[model samples]
Target chain A: MIKSLVSITGVALVCAALLAGVRYQTAPHIRANREAATWAVAFQLAGGPFPTNNVTLPLANLRIGGTRLDTVSTPGYGGSIEMLVALDRGSIGGVKVTRHEETPGLGDFIEGEWMNQFEQMQPMEVDTISGATITSLAIKRALQSHLRTALAETAPEGPPG
Target chain B: MTFRQAAIERNPAWVQLLGLCPLLAVSNSVVNALGLAFASTFVMAGSALIISLLRTLIPHDVRLPCFMMVIATFTTCAVMLLEAYTFDLYLSIALFVQIIVTNCMILGRLEAFAARQPPRAALADALGTSCGFAIALLVLGSVREIIGAGSLGAGLDSLFGPDAADWGIDFTDEGGGMLVALLPPGAFILAGLLLGLGRGIHEQRQARAHLRETEG
Candidate 1:
């Protein structure tokens, strides 16, 4: 019994060691690739017209990052919706209707291009999502609260909008 | 557990009730949940396969540390694959993807199923768990993607290839789309409704099965 156990344990160790080595070997490349992609998105979110390969700028004000807008819940035409606003500095960055729980065939465009109208629009210019009025109000109110909070808070030096 | 047993009978969500945070947090859309489910399954299966295969050699004194080392390695690989091939998905998932290393389901299956069973059985358990997980994720994704985006699998272009643009459906005419479904809070409520929906289906199936039994 002890011998069988030892053999099983030995096999386990050898297999794991081999797999671990493969993982470690490729770790650095994966890390670099992911970082590069994030930097690109940050610039895009910041409304940078040119691709600034430079990622981090600790010394500069208006660095780039995705600002998660105030999330709120409401009965949409489909179900529920989550509105995330990407902000650069105090200016509106970009708006992504991150998720929509509305009905698929009837009212799914809450996250589509039509919502782009609100991308850089001011807090007061909040528009309603057609076929999803309750969802629209909930989102607008949450965004207003976010804009209010952002105005109240000291702006972080992220990418300029 | 057997694949059938773990997947349907003793499901991690409906039955075992493990890993609910990541489950609920990531299950907002099919894309999000699918990304996470694949990552989680990879880690669980890879580690279990490695560990069970090596069950003969490791010293008992350092087994836990060894197990961790094995688990971490696979988790790192899962993250790397996402970063490489699915960079957008990787960014959307962000930290939650990394947190898979700490998910008890991986470790739990390692200890309970993998350690006690052979590599094949362990693989089966991992497959079962992931299948169960994928079902949950796909359900969530279908609900959120279809309802939130007004289409199913929108933005699958990036996932598929350049040619996929022709495949997506356009549902909006003007003043289209809801915002709440796309953001964070949507994740929470969307998942809740999906879970409720899953339960409702299960109950209906059970009721139908009972009716069939009575008639027979």
Candidate 2:
């Protein structure tokens, strides 16, 4: 009993220490990678380069080129999907799922060309992908509700650049 | 076991039917298969080597825990490295990689082979087993990608560098292919056919050997 306990304890301690070391070394790089991917999508949605090349995240409402970009999270097949929705002149300029826990082969269609169906279309007139009904409905519902409030605010005049 | 036997004759994924969950999940694309294969290779070899070296110190009663810790540690390390270096590939297959610790193939090898072998022998087994698993994944991935997506290596850029974006070959125009081949059920169908093919080959080889013996 003593030997088993000691062996497990020693093994656990060593593995934990090893993982800590690896985490310390890779944490910064992982953070940078995620930030870069998010920014890449953000820039793509906004239609061009930001005024400043050195801008970092926490962009505060994420407005670019008169388009309002919102990070919306809605319940998907497996869990909540975080999407970057670009609202441009009452139409969807672009849509990108920044994060999702949906099943890979089933619900991943949202991140592919299937999402192009929403591009330049009125938010409320979108149809969900056939196989990925739950995920698509979640994204569509979120966008419609979000648009209801957003369009009302910007209806008086076009969104400010 | 010899490397040849481990890799082919008694293949982990094919013969043992171990690690089928991740195999089917990530084998949808060639790039995804290669990414998982690379990570699995690193984790299997690393954990096997560590376990063999510490086998004597590990008590029989607690050997399972020790093996689990080693395998989990290597899996975490693989994930970190992939995230830091090949973040694109990591993003595409993050869930699969994180679950490598639960892959019975690794734990099975550690228990049945590594715990009783020398470090060098254990490393050889690890490499051979990894190769076997990689072969199964690559075969399933290639067939699925080609028939299902109408392309081969379509997303090679994610695994290889940006320069490899054009490495893929598209058989159909406008990216049209049999969509069912890329779906979850497609994995099972392709895997089953491939297993049958493998079994046929094995039986053929054995029959020929038996014929030679009988004639002799």
Question: Which predicted model would earn the best TM-score?
Answer: 2
**lDDT of each residue in B48-127, candidate 2, tens digit only:** 99899889989898888799889989999999999998998988898899999999999999999999999999999999
A25-109: candidate 1 lDDT, tens digit per residue: 6677666674555444444555664444552421123333444333334445565665545655566666655446565434656
Question: Candidate 2 docking: what grade?
Answer: medium
What are the per-model DockQ values?
Answer: 0.13, 0.73
Clashing pairs in 2: none
Which one wins on DockQ? 2
Give every candidate's TM-score on chain A.
0.47, 0.77
Query: Could you tally the backbone clashes for each prediction?
Result: 48, 0
**Tens digit of lDDT per residue, candidate 2, span A28-126?**
999989778887888788887676465555443567768987777789999988877788787787888887888877898888887777785755567
Superposition error at B168 for model 1 (Å): 3.8
